[model samples]
Target: MRDDVRRLLASYEPARQQPDPPLPPAGVLLLLHDRPGGPHVIFQKRTDRVRDHKGQISFPGGVMDPGDPDVRYTALRETHEEIGVRPDDVDVLGELDQMVTVSNFLVTPFVGWLDRYPYEWRFSSEEVAYLLEVPLSHLRDPRNLVPDRRIINGREYVFQAYRFGDDLIWGATARMLGNFLDLLSALE
Candidate 1:
Protein backbone atom coordinates (compact mmCIF):
# COMPACT_ATOMS: atom_id res chain seq x y z
CA MET A 1 0.00 0.00 0.00
CA ARG A 2 2.90 2.35 0.78
CA ASP A 3 4.37 1.59 -2.63
CA ASP A 4 0.99 2.24 -4.23
CA VAL A 5 0.76 5.57 -2.44
CA ARG A 6 4.26 6.49 -3.54
CA ARG A 7 3.41 5.53 -7.11
CA LEU A 8 0.25 7.62 -7.04
CA LEU A 9 2.14 10.61 -5.67
CA ALA A 10 4.95 10.19 -8.18
CA SER A 11 2.44 10.14 -11.03
CA TYR A 12 0.42 13.02 -9.55
CA GLU A 13 -1.61 15.34 -11.72
CA PRO A 14 -3.71 18.26 -10.63
CA ALA A 15 -7.38 17.81 -11.52
CA ARG A 16 -8.27 21.28 -10.22
CA GLN A 17 -6.11 23.78 -12.03
CA GLN A 18 -6.91 27.05 -10.29
CA PRO A 19 -8.82 27.71 -7.12
CA ASP A 20 -11.10 30.72 -6.83
CA PRO A 21 -9.64 33.56 -4.79
CA PRO A 22 -10.98 35.42 -1.71
CA LEU A 23 -11.87 32.02 -0.29
CA PRO A 24 -10.33 31.23 3.09
CA PRO A 25 -7.75 28.46 2.98
CA ALA A 26 -8.42 25.21 4.85
CA GLY A 27 -6.65 21.86 5.13
CA VAL A 28 -7.88 18.34 5.72
CA LEU A 29 -5.97 15.24 6.77
CA LEU A 30 -6.93 11.88 5.29
CA LEU A 31 -5.43 9.65 7.97
CA LEU A 32 -5.33 5.94 7.19
CA HIS A 33 -4.36 3.28 9.74
CA ASP A 34 -4.04 -0.49 9.55
CA ARG A 35 -6.85 -2.28 11.32
CA PRO A 36 -7.33 -6.02 11.71
CA GLY A 37 -8.76 -6.86 8.31
CA GLY A 38 -7.27 -4.07 6.21
CA PRO A 39 -6.45 -0.38 6.06
CA HIS A 40 -9.12 1.91 7.53
CA VAL A 41 -9.63 5.64 7.43
CA ILE A 42 -10.85 7.69 10.36
CA PHE A 43 -13.68 10.18 10.20
CA GLN A 44 -15.59 12.30 12.67
CA LYS A 45 -19.28 13.06 12.91
CA ARG A 46 -19.38 16.75 13.75
CA THR A 47 -21.45 17.75 16.72
CA ASP A 48 -24.83 19.35 16.05
CA ARG A 49 -23.83 22.29 18.20
CA VAL A 50 -21.02 23.27 15.82
CA ARG A 51 -21.41 26.22 13.48
CA ASP A 52 -20.76 24.76 10.02
CA HIS A 53 -21.62 21.42 8.49
CA LYS A 54 -23.01 20.16 11.76
CA GLY A 55 -23.72 16.43 11.96
CA GLN A 56 -21.72 15.81 8.81
CA ILE A 57 -19.16 13.03 8.56
CA SER A 58 -15.78 14.66 7.91
CA PHE A 59 -12.04 14.22 8.12
CA PRO A 60 -10.22 15.64 11.13
CA GLY A 61 -9.35 19.15 10.01
CA GLY A 62 -10.40 22.79 10.00
CA VAL A 63 -9.65 26.26 8.72
CA MET A 64 -6.03 27.35 8.78
CA ASP A 65 -4.86 29.48 11.66
CA PRO A 66 -2.57 32.48 11.27
CA GLY A 67 0.01 30.69 13.38
CA ASP A 68 0.16 27.75 10.96
CA PRO A 69 3.44 27.65 9.05
CA ASP A 70 1.92 26.02 5.98
CA VAL A 71 -1.09 24.11 4.71
CA ARG A 72 0.37 20.74 5.70
CA TYR A 73 1.10 22.07 9.15
CA THR A 74 -2.42 23.41 9.31
CA ALA A 75 -3.76 19.95 8.54
CA LEU A 76 -1.46 18.31 11.08
CA ARG A 77 -2.23 20.87 13.77
CA GLU A 78 -5.94 20.66 13.20
CA THR A 79 -5.85 16.88 13.26
CA HIS A 80 -3.92 16.97 16.52
CA GLU A 81 -6.37 19.45 18.01
CA GLU A 82 -9.45 17.58 16.82
CA ILE A 83 -8.53 13.91 17.17
CA GLY A 84 -5.32 13.79 19.25
CA VAL A 85 -3.20 12.48 16.36
CA ARG A 86 0.24 13.99 16.74
CA PRO A 87 1.94 15.44 13.69
CA ASP A 88 5.03 13.33 14.37
CA ASP A 89 2.93 10.17 14.31
CA VAL A 90 1.84 10.72 10.72
CA ASP A 91 3.87 9.80 7.64
CA VAL A 92 2.61 12.11 4.93
CA LEU A 93 2.35 10.26 1.61
CA GLY A 94 1.27 13.15 -0.58
CA GLU A 95 -1.56 15.53 -1.37
CA LEU A 96 -4.62 15.64 -3.58
CA ASP A 97 -5.73 18.53 -5.74
CA GLN A 98 -7.00 21.68 -4.11
CA MET A 99 -10.79 21.81 -3.82
CA VAL A 100 -13.09 24.77 -3.36
CA THR A 101 -16.37 24.22 -1.58
CA VAL A 102 -19.69 26.02 -1.90
CA SER A 103 -19.01 27.61 1.49
CA ASN A 104 -16.06 29.52 0.05
CA PHE A 105 -13.20 27.45 1.39
CA LEU A 106 -10.14 26.49 -0.64
CA VAL A 107 -9.35 23.11 0.90
CA THR A 108 -6.05 21.33 0.42
CA PRO A 109 -6.32 17.65 1.26
CA PHE A 110 -3.30 15.71 2.55
CA VAL A 111 -2.99 11.94 2.61
CA GLY A 112 -1.15 10.48 5.62
CA TRP A 113 -0.41 7.05 7.05
CA LEU A 114 -0.05 6.07 10.73
CA ASP A 115 2.44 3.25 9.99
CA ARG A 116 1.38 1.60 13.25
CA TYR A 117 -1.84 -0.30 13.93
CA PRO A 118 -4.86 -0.28 16.28
CA TYR A 119 -5.02 3.43 17.08
CA GLU A 120 -6.54 4.84 20.24
CA TRP A 121 -8.43 8.03 19.48
CA ARG A 122 -9.70 10.80 21.73
CA PHE A 123 -12.26 13.19 20.37
CA SER A 124 -12.74 16.89 21.10
CA SER A 125 -16.17 17.31 22.63
CA GLU A 126 -16.65 20.79 21.20
CA GLU A 127 -16.25 19.61 17.62
CA VAL A 128 -16.75 15.87 17.24
CA ALA A 129 -19.69 13.70 18.24
CA TYR A 130 -17.93 10.36 17.72
CA LEU A 131 -15.18 8.76 15.72
CA LEU A 132 -15.86 6.47 12.74
CA GLU A 133 -13.33 3.93 11.49
CA VAL A 134 -14.27 2.59 8.08
CA PRO A 135 -12.55 -0.17 6.20
CA LEU A 136 -11.04 0.78 2.83
CA SER A 137 -12.36 -2.46 1.37
CA HIS A 138 -15.91 -1.40 2.18
CA LEU A 139 -15.41 1.84 0.26
CA ARG A 140 -13.93 -0.09 -2.68
CA ASP A 141 -17.27 -1.82 -3.19
CA PRO A 142 -19.17 -0.24 -6.10
CA ARG A 143 -22.55 -0.81 -4.45
CA ASN A 144 -21.58 1.42 -1.52
CA LEU A 145 -21.04 4.40 -3.78
CA VAL A 146 -24.20 6.25 -4.76
CA PRO A 147 -25.13 9.41 -6.57
CA ASP A 148 -26.78 11.97 -4.30
CA ARG A 149 -29.12 14.53 -5.77
CA ARG A 150 -31.14 17.33 -4.26
CA ILE A 151 -32.94 20.52 -5.22
CA ILE A 152 -31.75 23.69 -3.57
CA ASN A 153 -33.59 26.91 -4.46
CA GLY A 154 -35.17 25.02 -7.40
CA ARG A 155 -31.72 24.05 -8.73
CA GLU A 156 -30.80 20.39 -8.91
CA TYR A 157 -27.35 19.39 -7.74
CA VAL A 158 -25.72 16.00 -7.65
CA PHE A 159 -22.74 14.58 -5.83
CA GLN A 160 -21.16 11.23 -4.96
CA ALA A 161 -21.85 9.60 -1.60
CA TYR A 162 -20.41 6.56 0.13
CA ARG A 163 -22.65 4.86 2.67
CA PHE A 164 -21.41 3.18 5.83
CA GLY A 165 -24.19 1.73 7.92
CA ASP A 166 -26.66 4.66 8.19
CA ASP A 167 -24.04 7.40 7.75
CA LEU A 168 -23.53 9.09 4.41
CA ILE A 169 -20.18 10.60 3.49
CA TRP A 170 -20.89 13.35 0.99
CA GLY A 171 -19.64 16.80 -0.01
CA ALA A 172 -15.97 17.70 0.29
CA THR A 173 -15.07 14.75 2.49
CA ALA A 174 -16.61 12.39 -0.04
CA ARG A 175 -14.72 14.10 -2.83
CA MET A 176 -11.41 13.59 -1.03
CA LEU A 177 -12.27 9.97 -0.25
CA GLY A 178 -13.31 9.35 -3.83
CA ASN A 179 -10.04 10.77 -5.07
CA PHE A 180 -8.06 8.61 -2.68
CA LEU A 181 -10.00 5.53 -3.72
CA ASP A 182 -9.48 6.34 -7.37
CA LEU A 183 -5.74 6.68 -6.76
CA LEU A 184 -5.64 3.26 -5.09
CA SER A 185 -7.80 1.63 -7.76
CA ALA A 186 -5.54 2.92 -10.51
CA LEU A 187 -2.73 0.78 -9.11
CA GLU A 188 -4.76 -2.42 -9.61
Candidate 2:
Protein backbone atom coordinates (compact mmCIF):
# COMPACT_ATOMS: atom_id res chain seq x y z
CA MET A 1 0.00 0.00 0.00
CA ARG A 2 2.79 2.38 0.91
CA ASP A 3 4.61 1.65 -2.33
CA ASP A 4 1.43 2.17 -4.30
CA VAL A 5 0.82 5.51 -2.64
CA ARG A 6 4.35 6.61 -3.34
CA ARG A 7 4.05 5.65 -7.00
CA LEU A 8 0.72 7.39 -7.39
CA LEU A 9 1.95 10.61 -5.87
CA ALA A 10 5.13 10.59 -7.91
CA SER A 11 3.14 10.73 -11.11
CA TYR A 12 0.50 13.07 -9.78
CA GLU A 13 0.63 16.72 -10.72
CA PRO A 14 -1.14 18.76 -8.08
CA ALA A 15 -3.37 21.59 -9.13
CA ARG A 16 -2.13 25.10 -8.37
CA GLN A 17 -4.22 28.21 -7.84
CA GLN A 18 -3.12 31.80 -8.28
CA PRO A 19 -5.16 34.59 -6.74
CA ASP A 20 -4.69 38.27 -7.37
CA PRO A 21 -2.53 39.96 -4.74
CA PRO A 22 -1.03 36.68 -3.66
CA LEU A 23 -1.68 35.32 -0.18
CA PRO A 24 1.14 34.45 2.19
CA PRO A 25 2.38 30.88 1.69
CA ALA A 26 1.84 28.27 4.37
CA GLY A 27 2.39 24.51 4.48
CA VAL A 28 0.84 21.57 6.32
CA LEU A 29 1.93 17.99 6.80
CA LEU A 30 -0.64 15.24 6.41
CA LEU A 31 1.11 12.40 8.19
CA LEU A 32 0.05 8.80 7.72
CA HIS A 33 1.09 6.01 10.06
CA ASP A 34 0.44 2.30 9.81
CA ARG A 35 -0.96 1.24 13.14
CA PRO A 36 -2.49 -1.98 14.46
CA GLY A 37 -5.96 -1.22 13.15
CA GLY A 38 -4.66 0.07 9.79
CA PRO A 39 -3.43 3.42 8.55
CA HIS A 40 -4.27 6.56 10.53
CA VAL A 41 -3.81 10.24 9.90
CA ILE A 42 -2.65 12.71 12.52
CA PHE A 43 -4.35 16.01 13.30
CA GLN A 44 -3.98 18.63 15.96
CA LYS A 45 -6.84 20.43 17.61
CA ARG A 46 -5.64 23.99 17.88
CA THR A 47 -5.98 26.06 21.04
CA ASP A 48 -8.02 29.23 21.13
CA ARG A 49 -4.83 31.21 21.62
CA VAL A 50 -3.81 30.76 17.98
CA ARG A 51 -3.88 33.93 15.88
CA ASP A 52 -5.87 32.28 13.06
CA HIS A 53 -8.08 29.24 12.85
CA LYS A 54 -8.44 29.34 16.61
CA GLY A 55 -9.80 26.15 18.16
CA GLN A 56 -9.87 24.40 14.81
CA ILE A 57 -8.80 20.94 13.75
CA SER A 58 -5.84 21.10 11.37
CA PHE A 59 -2.74 19.34 10.14
CA PRO A 60 0.52 20.22 11.86
CA GLY A 61 1.77 23.28 10.02
CA GLY A 62 2.08 27.05 9.92
CA VAL A 63 3.07 30.00 7.81
CA MET A 64 6.47 29.96 6.16
CA ASP A 65 9.30 31.78 7.85
CA PRO A 66 11.55 34.08 5.86
CA GLY A 67 14.55 31.80 6.29
CA ASP A 68 12.75 28.68 5.08
CA PRO A 69 14.10 27.40 1.76
CA ASP A 70 10.73 26.30 0.40
CA VAL A 71 7.16 25.45 1.36
CA ARG A 72 8.24 21.83 1.87
CA TYR A 73 10.79 22.92 4.42
CA THR A 74 8.17 25.05 6.11
CA ALA A 75 5.90 22.02 6.35
CA LEU A 76 8.64 19.85 7.87
CA ARG A 77 9.79 22.57 10.23
CA GLU A 78 6.30 23.29 11.47
CA THR A 79 5.54 19.60 11.82
CA HIS A 80 8.63 19.15 13.96
CA GLU A 81 7.85 22.19 16.08
CA GLU A 82 4.19 21.31 16.50
CA ILE A 83 4.32 17.52 16.84
CA GLY A 84 7.94 16.57 17.65
CA VAL A 85 8.33 14.64 14.42
CA ARG A 86 11.81 15.05 13.03
CA PRO A 87 11.98 16.06 9.40
CA ASP A 88 14.41 13.28 8.66
CA ASP A 89 12.10 10.70 10.18
CA VAL A 90 9.27 11.27 7.78
CA ASP A 91 9.15 9.59 4.39
CA VAL A 92 7.59 12.40 2.40
CA LEU A 93 5.34 10.87 -0.22
CA GLY A 94 4.33 13.84 -2.30
CA GLU A 95 2.16 16.94 -2.35
CA LEU A 96 -1.55 17.54 -2.85
CA ASP A 97 -3.26 20.53 -4.43
CA GLN A 98 -2.59 23.98 -3.05
CA MET A 99 -5.49 25.57 -1.21
CA VAL A 100 -6.44 29.15 -0.34
CA THR A 101 -7.84 29.63 3.12
CA VAL A 102 -10.33 32.21 4.33
CA SER A 103 -7.55 33.57 6.53
CA ASN A 104 -5.71 34.43 3.29
CA PHE A 105 -3.04 31.79 3.24
CA LEU A 106 -1.89 29.77 0.24
CA VAL A 107 -1.46 26.40 1.90
CA THR A 108 0.61 23.60 0.35
CA PRO A 109 -0.28 20.21 1.73
CA PHE A 110 2.35 17.44 1.87
CA VAL A 111 1.72 13.79 2.49
CA GLY A 112 4.27 11.94 4.64
CA TRP A 113 4.50 8.38 5.92
CA LEU A 114 5.70 7.29 9.35
CA ASP A 115 7.01 3.78 9.91
CA ARG A 116 6.60 3.54 13.65
CA TYR A 117 3.79 3.75 16.15
CA PRO A 118 3.78 4.84 19.81
CA TYR A 119 5.66 7.95 18.81
CA GLU A 120 6.83 10.20 21.58
CA TRP A 121 5.02 13.40 20.73
CA ARG A 122 5.93 16.70 22.35
CA PHE A 123 3.42 19.27 21.20
CA SER A 124 3.32 22.99 21.87
CA SER A 125 0.95 23.44 24.79
CA GLU A 126 0.00 26.94 23.74
CA GLU A 127 -0.89 25.95 20.16
CA VAL A 128 -2.20 22.43 20.45
CA ALA A 129 -5.12 21.36 22.61
CA TYR A 130 -4.84 17.66 21.78
CA LEU A 131 -3.79 15.30 19.01
CA LEU A 132 -6.36 13.29 17.10
CA GLU A 133 -5.32 10.07 15.32
CA VAL A 134 -8.15 9.06 13.03
CA PRO A 135 -8.34 5.83 11.11
CA LEU A 136 -8.26 6.02 7.31
CA SER A 137 -11.26 3.70 7.14
CA HIS A 138 -13.36 6.08 9.19
CA LEU A 139 -12.31 9.06 7.13
CA ARG A 140 -12.94 7.22 3.83
CA ASP A 141 -16.45 6.19 4.83
CA PRO A 142 -19.02 8.17 2.83
CA ARG A 143 -21.41 8.08 5.77
CA ASN A 144 -18.99 10.17 7.85
CA LEU A 145 -19.36 13.18 5.60
CA VAL A 146 -21.78 15.64 7.20
CA PRO A 147 -23.23 18.91 6.06
CA ASP A 148 -21.98 21.89 8.04
CA ARG A 149 -23.78 25.23 7.98
CA ARG A 150 -22.25 28.45 9.28
CA ILE A 151 -22.97 32.16 9.23
CA ILE A 152 -19.97 34.28 8.42
CA ASN A 153 -20.30 38.04 8.12
CA GLY A 154 -24.12 37.65 8.31
CA ARG A 155 -24.12 35.25 5.34
CA GLU A 156 -25.06 31.61 5.63
CA TYR A 157 -22.99 28.95 3.84
CA VAL A 158 -23.11 25.20 3.91
CA PHE A 159 -19.99 23.05 3.64
CA GLN A 160 -19.20 19.35 3.62
CA ALA A 161 -17.28 18.20 6.68
CA TYR A 162 -16.00 15.06 8.31
CA ARG A 163 -17.28 14.14 11.75
CA PHE A 164 -15.08 11.81 13.74
CA GLY A 165 -16.75 11.36 17.09
CA ASP A 166 -17.18 14.87 18.53
CA ASP A 167 -14.46 16.54 16.50
CA LEU A 168 -15.59 18.25 13.33
CA ILE A 169 -13.06 18.86 10.55
CA TRP A 170 -14.11 21.60 8.15
CA GLY A 171 -12.73 24.64 6.40
CA ALA A 172 -9.38 24.37 4.61
CA THR A 173 -8.42 21.20 6.37
CA ALA A 174 -11.54 19.39 5.22
CA ARG A 175 -10.99 20.49 1.66
CA MET A 176 -7.43 19.17 1.73
CA LEU A 177 -8.66 15.88 3.17
CA GLY A 178 -11.27 15.60 0.47
CA ASN A 179 -8.62 16.01 -2.22
CA PHE A 180 -6.47 13.31 -0.69
CA LEU A 181 -9.41 10.93 -0.37
CA ASP A 182 -10.26 11.51 -4.00
CA LEU A 183 -6.74 10.52 -4.98
CA LEU A 184 -6.99 7.39 -2.85
CA SER A 185 -10.25 6.44 -4.51
CA ALA A 186 -8.60 6.68 -7.91
CA LEU A 187 -6.05 4.12 -6.80
CA GLU A 188 -8.70 1.53 -6.08
Candidate 3:
Protein backbone atom coordinates (compact mmCIF):
# COMPACT_ATOMS: atom_id res chain seq x y z
CA MET A 1 0.00 0.00 0.00
CA ARG A 2 2.82 2.37 0.90
CA ASP A 3 4.54 1.44 -2.34
CA ASP A 4 1.40 2.26 -4.31
CA VAL A 5 0.92 5.59 -2.59
CA ARG A 6 4.58 6.40 -3.14
CA ARG A 7 4.24 5.63 -6.80
CA LEU A 8 1.10 7.74 -7.04
CA LEU A 9 2.72 10.77 -5.45
CA ALA A 10 5.98 10.23 -7.28
CA SER A 11 4.24 10.19 -10.65
CA TYR A 12 2.46 13.44 -9.81
CA GLU A 13 3.83 16.95 -9.79
CA PRO A 14 4.92 18.09 -6.37
CA ALA A 15 3.56 21.12 -4.57
CA ARG A 16 5.42 24.44 -4.87
CA GLN A 17 6.18 26.26 -1.64
CA GLN A 18 8.53 29.13 -0.90
CA PRO A 19 11.68 28.72 1.16
CA ASP A 20 10.85 29.63 4.73
CA PRO A 21 12.95 31.83 7.00
CA PRO A 22 12.53 30.25 10.44
CA LEU A 23 9.98 27.83 11.81
CA PRO A 24 7.71 28.70 14.69
CA PRO A 25 6.42 25.12 15.27
CA ALA A 26 5.26 21.95 13.55
CA GLY A 27 1.99 20.08 12.80
CA VAL A 28 0.60 16.83 11.38
CA LEU A 29 -1.81 15.43 8.74
CA LEU A 30 -3.27 12.03 9.55
CA LEU A 31 -4.58 10.31 6.38
CA LEU A 32 -6.94 7.72 7.78
CA HIS A 33 -8.95 5.48 5.45
CA ASP A 34 -9.08 4.90 1.68
CA ARG A 35 -12.09 2.95 0.59
CA PRO A 36 -13.05 1.81 -2.92
CA GLY A 37 -14.19 5.18 -4.26
CA GLY A 38 -11.67 7.35 -2.48
CA PRO A 39 -9.92 8.00 0.80
CA HIS A 40 -11.07 9.89 3.89
CA VAL A 41 -9.22 12.35 6.07
CA ILE A 42 -10.13 13.13 9.65
CA PHE A 43 -10.61 16.60 11.06
CA GLN A 44 -11.15 17.85 14.58
CA LYS A 45 -12.85 21.07 15.48
CA ARG A 46 -10.76 22.82 18.06
CA THR A 47 -12.87 23.85 21.05
CA ASP A 48 -12.97 27.51 22.04
CA ARG A 49 -11.29 26.55 25.27
CA VAL A 50 -7.97 26.10 23.53
CA ARG A 51 -5.69 29.08 23.26
CA ASP A 52 -4.47 28.36 19.74
CA HIS A 53 -6.48 27.82 16.56
CA LYS A 54 -9.63 27.53 18.62
CA GLY A 55 -12.88 26.56 16.85
CA GLN A 56 -11.05 25.70 13.65
CA ILE A 57 -11.14 22.41 11.79
CA SER A 58 -7.70 20.87 11.92
CA PHE A 59 -5.85 17.57 11.94
CA PRO A 60 -5.43 15.70 15.22
CA GLY A 61 -2.09 17.19 16.14
CA GLY A 62 -0.42 20.08 17.82
CA VAL A 63 3.03 21.52 18.54
CA MET A 64 5.82 18.99 18.87
CA ASP A 65 6.00 17.69 22.41
CA PRO A 66 9.32 18.10 24.18
CA GLY A 67 9.61 14.32 24.62
CA ASP A 68 8.94 13.70 20.94
CA PRO A 69 11.96 12.41 19.07
CA ASP A 70 10.82 14.01 15.80
CA VAL A 71 7.82 15.42 13.99
CA ARG A 72 6.63 11.95 13.02
CA TYR A 73 6.57 10.90 16.64
CA THR A 74 4.89 14.13 17.54
CA ALA A 75 2.14 13.49 14.98
CA LEU A 76 1.38 9.98 16.10
CA ARG A 77 1.64 10.78 19.77
CA GLU A 78 -0.57 13.80 19.50
CA THR A 79 -3.14 11.93 17.42
CA HIS A 80 -3.43 9.34 20.15
CA GLU A 81 -3.40 11.84 22.95
CA GLU A 82 -5.85 14.25 21.33
CA ILE A 83 -8.21 11.81 19.61
CA GLY A 84 -7.50 8.35 21.08
CA VAL A 85 -6.32 6.89 17.77
CA ARG A 86 -3.34 4.79 18.65
CA PRO A 87 -0.14 5.08 16.65
CA ASP A 88 -0.13 1.29 16.32
CA ASP A 89 -3.31 1.55 14.24
CA VAL A 90 -1.71 3.87 11.71
CA ASP A 91 0.41 2.69 8.80
CA VAL A 92 2.40 5.72 7.71
CA LEU A 93 2.58 5.77 3.92
CA GLY A 94 5.02 8.65 3.81
CA GLU A 95 5.07 12.40 4.10
CA LEU A 96 4.03 15.39 2.04
CA ASP A 97 6.44 18.29 1.75
CA GLN A 98 6.64 20.59 4.75
CA MET A 99 4.29 23.56 4.65
CA VAL A 100 4.73 26.93 6.30
CA THR A 101 1.65 28.20 8.07
CA VAL A 102 0.69 31.88 7.92
CA SER A 103 1.07 31.78 11.68
CA ASN A 104 4.76 30.99 10.99
CA PHE A 105 4.74 27.33 12.06
CA LEU A 106 6.69 24.91 9.89
CA VAL A 107 4.09 22.14 9.52
CA THR A 108 5.39 18.75 8.47
CA PRO A 109 2.50 16.68 7.11
CA PHE A 110 2.74 12.94 7.69
CA VAL A 111 0.56 10.79 5.44
CA GLY A 112 -0.64 7.47 6.84
CA TRP A 113 -3.39 4.88 6.40
CA LEU A 114 -6.01 3.84 8.91
CA ASP A 115 -7.28 0.28 8.53
CA ARG A 116 -10.94 0.44 9.57
CA TYR A 117 -13.84 2.85 10.05
CA PRO A 118 -15.16 1.25 13.23
CA TYR A 119 -13.01 2.75 15.93
CA GLU A 120 -13.23 5.09 18.86
CA TRP A 121 -12.04 8.68 19.24
CA ARG A 122 -11.30 10.20 22.64
CA PHE A 123 -11.37 13.89 22.03
CA SER A 124 -9.34 16.34 24.03
CA SER A 125 -12.20 18.57 25.08
CA GLU A 126 -9.91 21.51 25.68
CA GLU A 127 -8.64 21.18 22.13
CA VAL A 128 -11.17 19.20 20.12
CA ALA A 129 -14.91 19.67 20.40
CA TYR A 130 -15.89 17.33 17.58
CA LEU A 131 -14.54 15.18 14.75
CA LEU A 132 -15.55 15.03 11.09
CA GLU A 133 -14.73 12.95 8.04
CA VAL A 134 -13.98 14.45 4.62
CA PRO A 135 -14.16 12.43 1.46
CA LEU A 136 -10.87 12.71 -0.37
CA SER A 137 -12.78 12.77 -3.66
CA HIS A 138 -14.41 16.05 -2.67
CA LEU A 139 -11.10 17.88 -2.78
CA ARG A 140 -10.63 16.99 -6.46
CA ASP A 141 -13.45 19.22 -7.61
CA PRO A 142 -12.16 22.61 -8.75
CA ARG A 143 -15.59 24.13 -8.26
CA ASN A 144 -15.69 22.89 -4.68
CA LEU A 145 -12.59 24.86 -3.88
CA VAL A 146 -13.14 28.55 -4.38
CA PRO A 147 -10.49 31.25 -4.29
CA ASP A 148 -10.51 34.32 -2.13
CA ARG A 149 -8.57 37.30 -3.43
CA ARG A 150 -7.02 40.03 -1.39
CA ILE A 151 -4.97 43.08 -2.26
CA ILE A 152 -2.52 44.79 0.04
CA ASN A 153 -0.45 47.79 -1.05
CA GLY A 154 -1.76 47.41 -4.60
CA ARG A 155 -0.65 43.78 -4.77
CA GLU A 156 -2.98 40.87 -5.13
CA TYR A 157 -2.96 37.27 -3.93
CA VAL A 158 -5.39 34.38 -3.74
CA PHE A 159 -6.08 31.76 -1.11
CA GLN A 160 -7.96 28.52 -1.73
CA ALA A 161 -11.32 27.77 -0.09
CA TYR A 162 -12.78 24.32 0.53
CA ARG A 163 -16.48 24.06 1.17
CA PHE A 164 -17.32 20.70 2.75
CA GLY A 165 -20.89 20.26 3.89
CA ASP A 166 -21.46 23.06 6.40
CA ASP A 167 -17.81 23.23 7.41
CA LEU A 168 -15.34 25.50 5.65
CA ILE A 169 -11.92 23.88 5.96
CA TRP A 170 -9.45 26.60 5.03
CA GLY A 171 -6.16 28.12 6.05
CA ALA A 172 -3.05 25.94 6.30
CA THR A 173 -5.01 22.68 6.51
CA ALA A 174 -6.84 23.56 3.29
CA ARG A 175 -3.56 24.45 1.58
CA MET A 176 -2.06 21.13 2.60
CA LEU A 177 -5.21 19.27 1.57
CA GLY A 178 -5.24 21.18 -1.72
CA ASN A 179 -1.68 20.18 -2.41
CA PHE A 180 -2.49 16.58 -1.59
CA LEU A 181 -5.55 16.61 -3.86
CA ASP A 182 -3.51 18.14 -6.65
CA LEU A 183 -1.16 15.20 -6.36
CA LEU A 184 -4.00 12.69 -6.47
CA SER A 185 -5.56 14.45 -9.47
CA ALA A 186 -2.27 14.29 -11.30
CA LEU A 187 -2.15 10.56 -10.72
CA GLU A 188 -5.60 10.16 -12.24
- True lDDT of residue 69, candidate 3: 84
- TM-scores, all candidates, are 0.94, 0.97, 0.84
Ten residues in sequence with the least summed lDDT for candidate 3? 11-20
Can you list the residue pairs that collide in candidate 2?
A: none
| The best candidate in terms of lDDT | 2
Ranking by TM-score: 2, 1, 3
| Candidate 2 or 1, higher TM-score | 2
Q: Summing lDDT over every window of 10 consecutive residues in candidate 2, give the lowest-scoring window.
A: 1-10
lDDT of 2: 0.94
Q: Write the per-residue lDDT of candidate 3 for residues 41-143, one digit (tens) a residue.
A: 8988889988778788888877887778898888888888888888889887667767777666778887778867667778788788889887776766776
Candidate 2 local lDDT, 79-187, one digit each (tens) = 9999899998899999999999999999999999986888999999989999999999999999999999999999999998999999999999999999999999978
Q: Give candidate 2 regions above 4 Å deviation.
A: none
RMSD of each: 1.4, 1.0, 3.0
Q: Which parts of model 1 are misplaced by more than 4 Å?
A: 16-20
Better of 2 and 3 by TM-score: 2
